[model samples]
Target: MSGVAGDDPRDPAGETKLTFPESWQVESSDGLSASVMFISGLIMVTRNRYLAWPSLLLSINSVINQHPLRTKEGGNSPISTVILGVSALLASYLPLVMIGPQKQVPLPVPEAQ
Candidate 1:
């Protein structure tokens, strides 16, 4: 009962489940982190007006730089390059969306005395 009862239904080998931390789920997490850091710096400098522009630029750069090198050297498929490019662009903007500017609530005015 001890050895057999605890066996996993799928593997029955008691192997540990494979996992990566949320912070490192994908290979592009590094790029996401960099985008977040840069966005933070931009927010510090100019608040928020110019935040999206730099993030957009960096995302484009990352996709352009990443796809060709991987495809040419690693012999990856064109579809893979397209997927990677789209993924990188999405990942870059995801962090920005998470840290987007807070919505302001207008205070209620007091009735005149």
Candidate 2:
């Protein structure tokens, strides 16, 4: 093959460089954020203080770890995750604020021998 025709091993003139479409480019996965969001949703639904606090922390982590350029287009936003987390936290703890903590009844003490 002629070098001018790019059939030669060292010839790059006639070779068309392959380029994937912009849409074909792989975007970064949002698995951790998605999981955090899901957990936030569960926390909201259950209003469990134990789960709510950790879910908020995970949501913050997702925000901190997010990369704008590599993130998928039209994907879920980290801000939304944070909002959900805050909402979950509120849902878990708001009752205590509005209604106050329940007073514990003291058990009867036995007389000392």
Candidate 3:
């Protein structure tokens, strides 16, 4: 096959550069994301309204970031698409809702004279 723009998976001719993130940043983000999802699953299973709400929100932050729809044109990921479809299907019945305040505590009242 000719070395054409659409022929190469590596895109050796593309202008994009191969750069890596800081190890600590990668590790921390990976850890945080996994922990959030794990805790979210636990909260969801237990139906904890308060914690589940925040966890669900946190877990969704990477949806668009990791989704194939956000990838460059012609980029295809069958696994990603399948995962997204499954998540969407599961989300239809699983709703983590919060109706109460998430505040940790009220400010300490000053002593009255």
Report, for all candidates in order, the number of backbone clashes.
0, 0, 0
lDDT of 2 by residue, 1-113 (tens): 34455457666665688996554334655888889888888877877899988888989998998777666788888999999899989988998899997889999999999
* Candidate 3 lDDT over residue span 1-113, tens digit each: 57555676666665576798633222123443456656656654665555654555555654534643334454333344334434543543365343444768889999999
Per-residue C-alpha lDDT of model 1 across residues 1-113, encoded as one tens digit per residue: 56776565777566777896543122333354354455645554544544545555555555555544223333333344344444445555676689899889999999998
Model 2 Cα shift for residue 5 (angstroms): 28
- Model 2's alpha-carbon lDDT is 0.83
- In order of TM-score, best first, we have 2, 3, 1
TM-score of each: 0.26, 0.63, 0.32
Q: Which candidate number maximizes lDDT?
A: 2
**Best by the TM-score measure:** 2
Tell me the whole-model lDDT of each prediction, alpha carbons only.
0.51, 0.83, 0.50
Roughly what TM-score does model 1 have, to 2 decimal places?
0.26
Ranking by lDDT: 2, 1, 3
Reference-based lDDT, residue 106, model 3: 83
Higher-ranked by lDDT: 1 or 2: 2
